[model samples]
Target: MRKSPLWIASFLLLLLVQTSGLWAQSAKKASYRNNNEVRTVQGCEYEVLKGLAEITEVEKTRSKSESALGYDEYSVKFKFTPMEKGQQLMADFGENSFDFFLRSGYDRLPVGPKYLKHYYVHKGQKFAMEFLQTDDKTCREQYTYKSMGIPNDLFEAQDSIKAYKIQIAAEKLYKKEKEVNEAKGIAMAEDAATQASGNRPPETAPEEQPKEEEGPKEEEPLDEEDPKEEEPEVDLNLPSEEELRKKVEAELREKEGLKKSPDEMDLDALRAQIEKEERAKAKAEAAKQAELDQKNAIKREKQAAKERKKLEEQRRKEIKAKEEELRDELAEKLAAEKAALEARKAAIREQVTNEIRRESCVYDEKISGTIKVISVEEGPTEVESLFGYKEYVVTLKFKPDNYADLPRKERKLWDKTFTFKLDPKGKSANPGATYVRIHKLFKGNKYNGFAQRLSSGVCNDIMVYSPDLPIDASQVRK
Candidate 1:
């Protein structure tokens, strides 16, 4: 059996923790000394601090004295021959405390049959030690086992009972299938014989006999002497009974090649032959049925593929037609919308041209605005028309740069304003410029003409549209 080193180490670790302290030491040649009993096995041995292990042979249970527990009665019976003193000794029997037991001096022994599994101590054998180390001066030597090998106190033996139990269980399980198969074979053979006997044709009905007529006379007493002469040799050439029997046997042997007669065959052989023939026939039928099934499967798959392809083609055609219809509809709708939009834009352009021509030019027309208008305010409704256009004037209010710096008295004086007129709509000042229209001047009185902007790339901020308008105080109507 195979074993891992980790398994042995784990076993040793558990053993050390449970058994408490047992001072174990190792040497190439040594003996186990336990009080009065001193046992030597190979070179290394166990020096017991307590009564932990025993070296003895296994025997049948003996009658125990009263008051004593009969524990040894249930122990395993072992067969062993003790080795000569110090001749590569190995323990054949040991009932460990828990699986395998060890002490500080000698190796741990396994319970039952195989104790000291994979020998704990033998002269010059390499092995390992566990738990703690011995004092050997150097730091490495103190922590580890002997360099060439493990000392007797360090080495541990394994327990093989688990492996043995598993092997036995496996053996039992292995034989179970064969037993089942044999039983199944017998049952199958019996069934074949029963069915064979049942399938034979039933016995046919016996032929019917005709009744004799009652016209014949009774036997005469004078015919006894003439009996031999009357019936002159009528020869019948039919075969004898023995010949018929021989003929049947010859036919059976020659025609069917059967060495044994039908009645002579034993029940078991007859049943076995019947089962074998039935099995052969069943196998043949299964093979034939499989072939037919394969053909049908292939036929169905091909038909399904053909139908799938046809359906896919039909769907593709429908999608293509729908796409064409949608494309044409979209194009026609877009064309009609474009035509209607262009016609509407043309009508609006014509109406705007007519309005500009009919209204003509109007001068001195103003829109409301904000400025420093402190002087006066006038409206076209009160002043009446001047030159066929409304005249409106406004006063501008003065605002200081920084009101916070001025005294209250001086602030009122400085808060004065001027008056000016803003002509929002104006006609050309030069009547010769026929292109000038009322709408050409913007809110700042800047003319919306190409010549005005082309001369200087700036729109003038003039409120009065007249070309001769003045800003000098002398030109004002003071």
Candidate 2:
């Protein structure tokens, strides 16, 4: 029993399909097993673990398709060892020794090299590591500072903490300063009250002298009859007690009246009146000044308006003059153009009249001759015919049979060779033909059934007839 080639090929394809399906199932089971193992170690609860760790190694894992997934399926794995002795982390993932992985599309982790350089530069110092585990059993690794316990670089965290402390200290200092100022104000107010009280006059009355002893001591006796006993000693220079008492009463009244006497009150009233008068005078002066300023302003405004009007009038005149000048120039230009046009029309009329006269003459005249020479020539390449057709120059020299009977001007033309342009495809003279008849010869005439002149000073449409052909005598006779 021999196997056919087709059967072998089909068998191989079936085997391949079976093997691929088994392989896919095995891969899926392996991935699920790995996920289960990871989940067992890292519980399915949102948590973050932080520790100081040294980066031992970095690795790139196999890349998966990203078409179905929005983000890159490639991952970068990091392996690190805890700095503290006897410290163990559940983040250690399987035999690969990777603590966590970061989803990245780059061949090399973008931030890994820079972070490693910083670590080595700081004398192989350990970095603060953070492992984040979400409820979905996904794990991510990031660098952090232990003090902040947040996912931020060490330097950035330090700066932020320092700025926050500074701000807090500034606020505290401001509050303290405000409290101290308030205390100072209270102390100043208390001191001011104390000083005011100490400076006030005492309100208590003077104490009376003790009564004089009733028994007098032994006197030295009576030298001057005791001038003190005769009458109360009186000093004429000093005011009497009664007078002093009245003066004191008057001073008390003045003090009770806020220290102003009647005369001083009158002086104050006089000063107030003077101030009022001065104020009224100043007000009047101000009013006069304001009125003057208003008048001046009005005058200036009127002057400005007048100037504006004058300028407007002058501008209008100038515009009018310019308009008139332009109109005159336009009229002159139109006149010149009209004169040129008229002259051109007159020239065209004269040319048409001359052409008609020549045509009439040619209609009545007749000439026949034997062709002495006939030749064809290529026309000028640069100059095309008016009808946009290809043309050739044909030269004909003829000896007319009636040369002696023709007029002097006609005879002169008959002696000369006639050269003209003609469309080879249209009605034209042929070079191989012999006898030719010409009914007209003119300088400036269009092609009819006779000779016609072209703008190039050549003749066209000169009718040719062989000698055997019958002549129409009525058409050719004078």
Candidate 3:
């Protein structure tokens, strides 16, 4: 058959598009297969941790490493006995168990020494772990483990466990791809060596015999059909990406404390207003109390001043009364002294008058004579008296005026001297009237007085009654 050029060109273009589409579909299928392999490994790890395990020991060690720069690297290791029920499941797994560890989102866990000590405290307790599955079936689950009655803080770490699991899976995938490439390179090198040594019989014979015996294997048909039969079913009930984003946004709002109703916000504002009013009321009450205290202090000061004035007035009155009492006592003492002095002077005068009258009666005769001489004598005898009075002896010589007509005893006194004792302080005689008066009789003056004679010829009482006659002043000798 003859074909048109336009039809042939259309057929070629269609074949190119279908071939490109098939290549894209094959690449996508391979990517999904790799992701499924990683998820299956992670799910098996989660299943193992879900069972309870008794923690036998926990140890922490520190070591210096070049990777840690200048700081020490800290690591924690745990030993646990898996429960009997989980042992059968662990044995059934063909793959090796994962070495589980906590890591931070921002950096490696146990960045400081305190976190190392935190794991050391939970040594011999049984713990149950759970891996909370996410909405995305392909993503690793979150890790949460705790012992009975233990706080969640003991198991807390930074970042999310899912992120660490994802990183572990990526490292494993890289290692697996590297191993596969290395194996393919080794096979290619072996084939090239066989072709180059075609002339060497012994090396070529051993290799060619194995290839011949293993040719056209019966398992080839089963290998081709397995992928189609074992493909995983997709779940249509899972949430979409947009729904996940909304859910995450809602949780963030709740955590940041922004999810509040209008009524709740108003209630918070009312509470703040009430608190402010109460504080202002308390301040006003405090000010009022302070003012009342100031007024009370002023009143107390005035009362104290009144009390002090009263005390001062009472003190002055007491002082005045004491002075008056002292003055009255002094006046009474002076008056008593004056009355006693006057009484003593009157007694002395009466005593002198009585002594003179007694002497005058004893000497009945009077004599008139011219005094020739007069003398006074003081001796020890004058001072021998109770009143300490002084006595004097008065000696007189006189001429009798009527010598022939006088009696014989009186006639003898004319040309004779007479002596008399006199008390000048009135202890025995009237000194004022007799002794003192006799001292006025001058020499050679005429005197008329009574004289009494004693038995010893001494005159006892001699009175010069008056001067004989008023002589010329120039004629009298004082």
Candidate 4:
């Protein structure tokens, strides 16, 4: 069979591709030398495995920063041998991706992305995450490129057989750091071996020099100062393999010069200006506080004076009210005393008037008489007959007040001897001096039993009535 030259060339190209793919896969497997070993990086303890980043899958994905790292990503895993709380973590993802982040627990306590310090990890936490992040130069540009407008490419697409350019840069940085640490370790080991030979050469620190072949040296006797020599303790600040990788990445990022950084002299000037402004502010605050205090003191003094005036007015009003009350009480008491004295005077005047009225009607006794019979005669009993007449003897006697209750015989013996009987219709004497009826001449005829004899003034006839005897003898005679 005859083969064309073009067909032969195509077969050769395909064979070369398959061979390279196998070589890369085997290389990746062999690269993780310290995969299970515990090491401390950036104040945190963890295990790291170094290998070329494998592009396992490719698919369309969305992002707000630098567009899916050009649709290529690496899945890196990590394990903490014994995790603890509040540990600061940092890792070097290589020079291609200058920035790295922790996934799964610590996202909330401030610095989220990369390039600065301060990530306080969660309790007992580890991460195995895929990174499809922007390169440092592209992330700096979105002061313009909108995510919705058009996606900015962080990198070009990568080949299946090898890593992306950013990742290759990172790998070279990590390998260089590893070389440096290995050199330091070797130099220290050699220095210690030299000391064990017991012949002290110098006291300077060991140098990190190139390795050389040496023949066995015989043991020498100990010098005077050889026993005092001591190897230095291990350094806590030395970067582990993982931290060395990140430290290299940080150096490369700084060199890219994304933004201008201030040097030591500029920082010093900024510090001094801040201090000057603070001092001026403190002086102004003190003056403002003093002015406010003075205003408050004046207000308090005015208030106290107003209160004193109010109290003085109240005291004066109370004194005036008490004096008026006392004057009213005095007026009421004087009016009552005047009324009592007037009532006593009226009673005395009534008693005197009654005594004068009683004295006006009294009289003295004046005349006395005794009753006597002279003869018995008959008088007419028919109409139109001769006028009837009867006659009796008369007598007068001294039967005074003391002698009024005597016997008739004694009275007769005292009387003048004469018949003194009068007509039955004639008036008789009461043997008192108060009033009497007597004979009088009338119109050519003589009659007796006339109206009372005479007047006794304002009371007419007197009635001298006594308490013990109703009638008394009068000394006056008719």
Candidate 5:
């Protein structure tokens, strides 16, 4: 009977489950100590360190290229027997941690399509194992063992239970497959016997007829009893052994003649030709891929350069804008300083004009000498403008040069010249008074004198001045 689709699917699923379980069991028991094996093999002694295992008795052999990943992997068969029976060393290291795959036998289950060719294990008669180094502490890897030489530390302490477990598992699988094959063979034999018996003729006579008997019994066909027809003629033109030998010998002669030619090949020559072709194919593929990669790299570089240039331009524009702004700000500041300077100059001019205008002249026509007034007291002239002017005393100032001409004795006298000022509406000054009384306050003191006698003929002479000096009203500037 044909198998149902459902049954086939169930069988496949069952097989997957069993196979996964087996691999899982093996993986769980695959751990080994890197520093545990310190035994000597051949004539060489090896030391093992933590995460670095060393095995002796390593035999050199040709590397095989038929690994799952299509790469050549090196193998060193053991010279000394393994420490644990039925347990073999399979090196597996990666990242920082070094590991050894503890296998029951040399032949190991391939991991998967991805990792199968990349990492593999092989069985050997008697071999030592060691880990030279690892790619990292956390990745799977392997290193050159014989090339790196051996490490120090003969052995390390570790549990051996795991190694035993793997050995037991491998044995179980091997026995199970053997049993299955034997059982299949027995079942096939029984099937063949049953088929043979069913084809045999009856040995006894027929039973008594029933009430509703069948019509006449059918007789066997005569053709079945006839002897088999003679077999048809067969083609037998195949060459005899001697003819084949002669043909082979001729072919060998032709090959020998070709070898004698300059262009012909020997064993090594034929091997070199195969390797050269392989290398050429590999190089061509690599060159094509490299060209494609170069194009991609150039594209990326151009993009990066464009971006950099764009950034540089933006920075330059920003810097230029800032420079212009600074220039504008500096111009505004200078303009403000210039305006302030002009205002200060104008203020100085106004101050000088006020000082010049405040000076009053005190002239003595008797001696035709004139002196600038230092102080004034007015009771004569009176005038008012812009609000009512009040009577007041006014003080004037003189430079050092003006007093230097006076004699020492004359300098002691308070005043020798006088000028008066008045406002009409001011009660302090009487505009109607004919004789105006004036007072001189000099050197912070009061004095009165006539102006004519005080104006001595010589500018530095000491002289007496009559009291109650009078001055012309027109002499004062309006």
Candidate 6:
């Protein structure tokens, strides 16, 4: 039995189709997963099937940054059976060739998540819904793709689907039109009422009836009905507006009060009793105001006390800081004084040691010098000039008033203005080469000296003598 390839291929395809049908029939129930366990991707809806199986409505989602590749669509379900008894849902269409006609519905879905996030079951197929994003401006493009959880090639004939959908829509619209026409007929009665009130026929008034002629007839009496009967004085018991309002208000208040005891009722006594409601209301308001004021006063007093305490604490801190600073300053001053005193004592000790050594170490020479007082002046320039005026002076040391401190007596001598003439040999002899030292004394007993060769004869009051040592005149020449 040689079979053509086409025939063999067709047989295998038919077998596959029959096997799928069998599988579908066997697994004819909707399946779904637990909602809490699965996380649906954003902008995505699940298609649940077999009562518990997970299904995705669509994998494609539109993004603001990028346009969709083709067209994203939402699916409408179709069933071979009724929704409930004879009622049929719009989404349900006849399924003849497939378990579900995914492609037979509208090309694009609706625009709300609320409507799309649900599961629906049709004849042989379970459906999960999704809505496509739509705008009045965007044109919809038709597309076909694989459905989640369903292994079958689904094709949607665009024109056929559109035509059937139009037919279904026309049916819906015709029904709506019939309802509208019925409503219009009912609404015309309002126009008739308006015409009667205006004493004129409406613009859309119905055609009038023809008048009927009659033979000679007996005259009916005018006002045959009794006037008294027409104007019967029936008791309506309808209260006036003011009285009704008061009665209603009182009833409402009574109900609200829930006063059930008969002993609580006393109409005559209640009427006699003066109403203190306004007074009570006023008293309540006053009491509230008083309570509020008392609270505010307490709060203000507490705040004031806190502020006072803070200020006092701050003042105490400031005073304590100031005292500490003063103490520190006094301690620093005392320390400085002690340092100065120690320094002065060391200088004195050094001076006394040098003096003792000078006296002990006697050389085999004796020398004497004198200076005659000439003139005096009192400043740095005058002191400087003294250095230049001396002649043939061996050596002389002069301290200026503002220079350094000297031995107490020398300091006093330098403070006063004076002049001196010097004799290097004796008190009245001619000096050899002359040299002079000028010094400035400072407030801190600090001295600075400047020495130079004297020009000639200016040390009039100066005297110089060496008892334990002698200087070689030639060697000492300036």
RMSD of candidates 1 onward, in order = 27.7, 28.8, 40.2, 41.4, 29.4, 26.4
lDDT of 4 by residue, 1-478 (tens): 6645544554555456445543433322211122343333222233332222222222223332433233323322223211332221233333232212212111111111221112222322233332222212212110111121112222233221133333433444456556766898999999999889897668898888998989899899766666678978987887799989978777876889533345524666767788778878877887887788788878887887788788878877887887788778877776766665565456445434533443344334443432222322232232211122222122322233435577888555444432221211112112211122232111122111111111322232322222222222231122
* Number of clashing pairs per prediction, in order: 15, 0, 1, 12, 25, 37
Clashes of 1: 15
Best by lDDT: 3
| Model 4 regions lying over 4 Å from their true place | 1-280, 330-478
Error of 5 at 374 (Å): 26
- Residue by residue across 1-478, what tens digits does model 5's lDDT show? 7645544555565557555543443322122344444422221223322222332223222232333323222333223223443333334321232222222222222122222223332333222444233322222222323312222211220233344344445455556656766888999999998998876776998787778867998988666644667767988999999999988877897988642544654869778999999999999999999999999999999999999999999999999999999999988998988886777567556544533442322234432222343543443223331112323344422222334687877555535433233311111121222332233333344333323332322121222122332333332222
Off by over 4 Å in 6: 1-284, 314-326, 341-478
Q: Candidate 3 residues 1-478, lDDT tens each?
A: 7645544555565456545543443322112211221122222222323345444434444443432222233443333344433232223223322223443332233322444455444545555543221222322332223343323341443333455444444455556556766998999999999999777655454444445455675655444565457768998898899999989888997998777655557786778999999999999999998998889989888888888888888888988888788779878877877776666567656655655544434343655655544664553232232233444444676555666787888676555675433331122332222333545643444456433333222224443333442222222121
Tell me the whole-model lDDT of each prediction, alpha carbons only. 0.40, 0.46, 0.47, 0.37, 0.42, 0.41
- Clashing residue pairs, candidate 3? 446-468
**Residues forming the 10-long window of minimal summed lDDT in candidate 5:** 423-432
Model 3's C-alpha root-mean-square deviation from the true structure amounts to 40.2
Looking at model 6, residue 160 earns an lDDT score of 40
**TM-score of candidate 5 to 2 decimals:** 0.22
What is candidate 6's CA lDDT for residue 221? 72
- For residue 191, model 3's alpha carbon misses the true position, in angstroms, by 2.5
Residues 1-478 of candidate 1 have per-residue lDDT tens digits of 8535544554555457335423232242233322322322322332212111222333334333311222112132221222233321223223321112222332322222222333443222322222112222222122111112222332222233344334433444445545656888999999998998875788899988988878888877664475456666867987899999988888988888887766887989789999999999999999999998999999999999999999999989988998899889988988877775665456445534543442343322332222332332234431222222333343334334455677999567445543333221222111111111332311233221110111221112223223333222222221
lDDT of 2 at 378: 49
Q: Against the true structure, what is each candidate's TM-score?
A: 0.22, 0.22, 0.22, 0.15, 0.22, 0.22
Q: What range of 10 consecutive residues in model 4 has the weakest lDDT sum?
A: 141-150
